[model samples]
Target: MSGKGDCYDNAVMESFFGTLKNEWVHHQQYQSRYQARSDIFKYIEGFYNTVRLHSSLGYMSPNEFEAKYHDNP
Candidate 1:
């Protein structure tokens, strides 16, 4: 846990949500709460974790990074 007034404690989450809003949320319209939930779930699990390349992970998708780590670890 982090102490008071430490933004670094949640920087990763802030970055992730910023990317999500910029890439997906702001561009879409939702007709229902269920539809929004489903779409966001798909975007995160199907595309973001599997296909999107992250600079912090050396331009590899999250799935690729996880696979490499398990293979070597």
Candidate 2:
């Protein structure tokens, strides 16, 4: 476990969740927490991982980046 008040310990994860909520969760309405959870899972696993482009990755999707990296290596 991280020490108390150690913001750096979770900075990357906090940024990810903030982006996830801002880009997807805040724009949707769901009937239940379960439904929201299911949709979020699909968004992250199905769409975001495979399709969404990342500026930090030179506009390549995560899947694309991994494939290119592995193929080149």
lDDT by residue (1-73, candidate 2, tens digit) is 7898898889988988999999999999999999999999999999888889988899999999999999999
RMSD of each: 2.4, 2.1
How high is the CA lDDT of each candidate model? 0.95, 0.93
Model 1 residue 33 CA deviation (Å) reads: 1.2
Scored by Cα lDDT, where does model 2 land? 0.93
What residue runs in model 1 are displaced by over 4 Å at the alpha carbon?
A: 1-6, 66-73
RMSD in Å for model 2: 2.1
Best by TM-score: 2
Query: Against the correct fold, how does model 1 do in TM-score?
Result: 0.77
